[model samples]
Target chain A: MHGECCFESEVLAAVVECRWPERVESELRVHASGCAICADVALLAVALREDREVLKSIAAPPESGRVWWMAQLRARREAEKAASRPITAAQVFGAAATAWFAGACFGASSDWFRSEFVRLASGAESAGIGVFLTSGVGLLLLLAAVSIIILVPAAVWLAVGKD
Target chain B: MFRDATLRDAIAAALAPADSESGSLVESQDVRADFAMDEDSFRSFYDRTARGLWAYLARVTGDRQAADDLLQDAFYRFLRAGTEYESEAHRRNSLYRIATNLARDARRRSVVRPDAVVSGEDIERVAGADSAGSLDLNADVERAMSRLRPNERAMLWLAYAEGEPHVEIADRLGLKVGSLKPLLFRARRKLAGLLRGKDSDHAR
Candidate 1:
């Protein structure tokens, strides 16, 4: 009986690890035929095997698209938030250029600037320097507006896309 | 013998009364019609196995969020692989193979970050009444899983948890069945050692 108990324990370990050999199975059957104690141990091992299989079925993870989708949405939001933080040096440079153009446009309309502009324009034969300044300022303003239109969308798209 | 007869009858009845109007039935029919028809077969297979797949993923990753992402990615790749399955086992084996690869990829991508923290709520949902008692067990399992090479963990889990035959495991994992025995033994020993440690800690 003691030997049977020991053998049964070893079988339990082997079976649990899925290493039970064909010889072990034959030995177990032989032991079970002669000894009731071994038979009981064999039954217990079988029960444990059955229980493990049942536990496996019970432990299986649930599948819900809703849960998975929520996870994906959370990951995507994190990626976007990470992407949206402080602008890089390139972006800062772009923003600085836009701000300078706006400042230049405002400066162009100033009275002191206008008087200096008229004096400079008087040197040019047909059209004053004011015409040159006005056209130049207009072109800068148009360039800034076009940049704002193109860049904001591009930045937003870059931030949200790819992931 | 009687039970086997009953089961066979039950299966036949289940398959016999298929509704033509049902989308799942239509999909199943489409899959059965063509060996080369990959999309419908994959979709049907995913629908059937997603829960089991997620369970395996959650157990492996120990993080519900990571498992969720990995599960979707795994299914996406399975659809793309477009392999014709000869049997139900083949289909399932393919799914697990894809999932294993996805988990490995995710692990490589985020080596520095801590694995997803499994919340108490997640534990309750997965472990149910044994949630409190199994916490240590779950932690031990996860730790053991982390110690294993990704493929080893994948092999051990599919073999033990899924009860896959060695041949199927070999087919799915692309390893010789004989080569897997020693590796599987080592993995199990590692897990058993971890569990023993956890048990001792609880005793203390």
Candidate 2:
């Protein structure tokens, strides 16, 4: 029942056109004076129309060309991101495979690796601090592993940044 | 809308095959390849809707600066949206919906709205220089509208400010058409009461 009036649209149309009580037909003005919904609609519509005008005076939306250019730039950037996804994935896979191959080669190279693997577990547990650093070969391998972990991503990022 | 003749010319220049020696023509062609609407069509659409859309954003967010950001964003998203429109009205509705959502998201991200600078050229000066009552009413309505919920403001605005149909208003706000009437009624009633209260105060 609320907000429902048979004359609501007629009243609304008149208000939108700035006719309302002043210029509308005598019968419609009489009805608006009596109908609660129509009266409220008129009051609200006039106020909002004014507010909209005020806002229009204040708002200066950017030029369409600037908007268009920004959209194009964003689209191109997104395209670059989309195109690089497979390359990024491949980079990660390549790094992992290299690490795995290096591990397998180290495992296969010497009986010393088997003994050292056992020593590594016990040495890491008991002789914690200097265990790897004390062994020259282990120290070299540790530094190499650390360097790759730190460097590969940085290199890729630099490469991407350059592009 | 077609007022930005300079920018339009620049866009035209960029889109045209001039200065091919720099290969910029090829780059611009690639840029156009992914655009949702061509240059002329987009210019026409922007000319038609930009002011209304800007006003809507300004009112809904209660900030002109935010409206600037949201207007550009809405158009960009609209272009990127790439949804086929059945008509100009449909496309306009789509842009409104996008703009509404963006305004909602912006309000959520920043709980405190930036103070909108109501410019020196007041609406009263432009709209009602001769009628003092109308001037007071405009300012009063502005203050009272700030008291409504954003959704309520949006509803009232789309309904009365834009003079949108119930169906278009419903679509723009993503509401069921049946429910929009009562909701609009409550919002209108509240706004009317607030406006009357001001009128009485002015009378005193």
DockQ for all models: 0.04, 0.28
Q: Write the per-residue lDDT of candidate 1 for residues A67-160, one digit (tens) a residue.
A: 2333333333343344444434445556556667656765775675566456555745567544654676544544665766787557645544
Chain A TM-score, each candidate: 0.28, 0.69
lDDT of 1 by residue, B45-119 (tens): 656787667666665665567776777767655644547778888778887878877776777787323363354
Instruction: Indicate the docking level reached by candidate 1.
Output: incorrect
Q: How badly does each model clash, as a count of residue pairs?
A: 3, 0
Q: For residues B1-204, could you state the per-residue lDDT of candidate 2 as single tens digits?
A: 544567657656754554353344235456567677986788789978998898888778777788888888899888888777899999999999999999999999994374543654554445545455555555686678788999998999999888999999999999999999888888888888887877733211
TM-score for candidate 1: 0.49
**Which candidate gets the maximum lDDT versus the true structure?**
2
lDDT of 2 at A120: 75
Q: Give Cα-based local distance difference scores for all models.
A: 0.55, 0.75
